[model samples]
Target: MVQPAQSPEPDRSPGPARSSEPARPSDVPADHVVVLFGATGDLARRKLLPGLFHLARAGLMPRRYRIVGSAPAAEALTDQEFRTHAQQAVAEFGRSRPEGPAWEAFAAGLSFGAADTGAAEPLMAAVREAETALGGTPRRLFHLAVPPVAFTSVIDLLGATGLAADGKVIVEKPFGTDLASARALNAAIHAVFDEARVFRIDHFLGKEAVDNVLALRFANGLFEPLWNRDHISHVQIDVPEHIDIQGRARFFEGTGTFRDMVVTHLFQLLGFIAMEPPVALEAGPLRDEQVKVFHSMRALDPAHVVRGQYGGYRDEQGVDPASDTETFVALRVAIDNWRWSGVPFQLRTGKALAEGRHMVTLGLREPVLRMFPLETRAAAEGRSNELVIDFDDPGSITARFLVKEPGPSMRLADGDMLFNYRTAFSAQNFLEGYEHLLLEAMRGNQSLFTRSDGVERLWEVAAPLLDAPPAVRPYAPGSWGPDGIDGLVAPYRWHLPDRRDATP
Candidate 1:
């Protein structure tokens, strides 16, 4: 039986105001060094280096900070060569290219090392040399941009070489393939670093609007009263991509849509949306609330879930002709708790769909406002009061409400109110999601990172679905997911993007 939603403890209170700007590390460690493990890898080129450059440009780089890139079999790059490489990467991937002086200062802090991270001696020796050059027992941050298989190995190496002292580790997600593996990985990490010293990255949690969910819910009284199962009919969290997997066949094969998106990104979003008000916004309190929600999630019923694969998936390179791997998934999850008991949380993500959107839409139950008359059923149906939070480029919050039409005789029309981040803040405030998260990790702020308990609970909710996956239906590319998903969220069709243009 579902339990009633728990209320906030009497003593619970909002924590310190969340930093409006990116957090700057206090007491810059003279020995601050950021080691990029997969320095020459694709993620480094596309996200890490560009994000670091943006941080430096924002004057958020610590006083003694330096970046040491490492990779086995990678050619050793001199400072200048690395700087040039970074410049190119930033040019290609950054939101905006940096100015000459800003780029130069950031580049001056760059260096490179080549070592097999699996081997303790060579990697440690390279890191030590970088530290010596900086001349301090600098706070070290090791970022693993490599594959998950290498996680334990690199962590073991870090401990064996004594680099784990006064050091922190940043691990990228899809934390583990499943619940059991996630437990093993967490145990391994705990052995090497204190829980407080480990930062797990889930870029979705760091987005500007997503980070504001707590503040929006707790900091204001306007929405809290209506934030329960009583007022919201259903919640839709949909992330659709219009492009095919761009050469990620190998990774995609090991992790389909469920593991890649549903388990990590979708669950983290659920944590924020359903958590009881935290006593404070500090890491511990915030994460505790998240864990509670995860624990409260009811086991997903196979009948309420749907899966699909875009046509031609098997034609993709590295894909098996007999592959039944799902490239798309849609789930209707019920939280077995008071506040969300009957409310179905709809989560769906797919590659090569019609629209490329990352947004959450909350369908509010129509209130008994006698002031507005529903002359027709269609009019009443169209009067859905929705709150949409779009998490993609140019993030925004949109409120759709009903208003009287200009014509006489009390006709009603749908209207929208939008708050776009780009318009509200300066262009500089539009940092890539990774930039904000990487900065927080550097500052040792775990508020935006996932906690171990929350992670395990996430897998617990997802493991059943993975262990016995639903049948995969085929859907054409450039179409909203499998047609059958429409029935899963019956009475409330997907809030799809406009069909004015087919291209992403």
Candidate 2:
């Protein structure tokens, strides 16, 4: 049996002063044309198209907008052919099946252009056609969803052809192979478009749970006082996937789990968790705080890192038989700051694990005075008092603590107080990760996007591991990770996600 928790009264804390005046029409996003490069790729098909459709369905899209897709000339597709392909993709991958007037209106704006890096005429021609159809000179937003190797060339193409003039660009991540490349990429992008006009996408930051991290800390009075080293023993951020690389060996081989997941996703999440309170919730202030956290992070020590490769990874198509790529990585990170001086942030992510989970757990320190006796052997040894945030679909927050067991003897047992988003706010509509980010980009909000300095700082923090990466130990397909992982978090065990805690 389950009991529903009562909703608490609204907070009376004084927040940023607000103007009661209604927003002017100028606040609305201007009509724009989204030029999607690598339009035929997996990201476009699975996330971009469906995300756009969701925005359209929610009426969040501008009054008049167009989506122009561009791919290589060899994969050229006609206008109707591309529309048909997008229709199929949206139908298959969209949150809901395409139907009714919303789908029809969204489909009307779909068009395609086939062009390669060497040629820009085709892509520009498509943009012109879309502008003509829109009946105005709308703003242009270029979304580069291409491979990293093609980033500079496409950027150069955009610059040389004057397509980047007065237009914003959205770049997908694994921004660069390493620190030097990341810096070079930044230089090239800055040469073409100003930093303010660039939006570096990190879909993890767009998650509802991730966004709530700020509200959970700032909006509430219960957690702030205990957020520092004084109360928190260690922090663990774990993201493990059950499935292996689904035929993306070409990409995964070049970008292993460390670069793909650690530098990009895990570090970004860590920033949010450990960032200082911003003076304001605006883009600059918020981003400044996140960057400060990155600055405080100590460079990853190779001794504190664990790399693992799942068995049978080489059997996958396109993988090198002797590939040294890591499919699993566990690291111990330290943030040297007044607030988090002695705290250890344990981070781990892997593919082909026992189960799939995306969550962060903060282990609270043991009480100074221990007067009660524990009847259970597990409790006697010590059980972690934790605060867990689940980032899976329908996110949840849970607090694990000790409670008195009903018995003649004085004993204690672990109990959890959970708040699940789905049950607590059943009527609320949550946007998909990419959907939220795409909408924010269109609205010219760079708060959720990563900045150039932050990206470079992350690379610098991971430099040690990237330069002299540890040996990749082999692990079974369905295991948690290599046996060495346990050694990384000595004395403190990994917080294995409990399915029950996530259930509403």
Best by lDDT: 2
lDDT of 1 by residue, 342-376 (tens): 99899999999986888888899987766766654
Relative to the unseen true structure, what is the C-alpha lDDT of residue 70 in candidate 1, on a scale of 0 to 100?
A: 74
The clash count for each model shown is: 5, 0
lDDT of 2 by residue, 1-504 (tens): 111111112112232111123234554467888999999988999999888876665556677888989998998888778778888888888864566556667777878887776687888888888877776678889999998888888889899988899899999998897899999999999999999999999888888899889999999899988899999999999999999998999999999999999888999999999998999888899999999999999999999999999999999999999999999999999999999998989999999999999899999998999788755544654456889999876688999888888998777887889988878763225677888889888889999999999999999988988889999999999999998887788778887656876885
Q: Please identify model 1 stretches exceeding 4 Å from their true place.
A: 1-31, 74-80, 117-122, 369-383, 497-504
Candidate 2, pairs of clashing residues: none
Q: Rate the local accuracy (lDDT) of all candidates.
A: 0.78, 0.84
Q: Would you estimate the TM-scores of all the predictions?
A: 0.90, 0.92
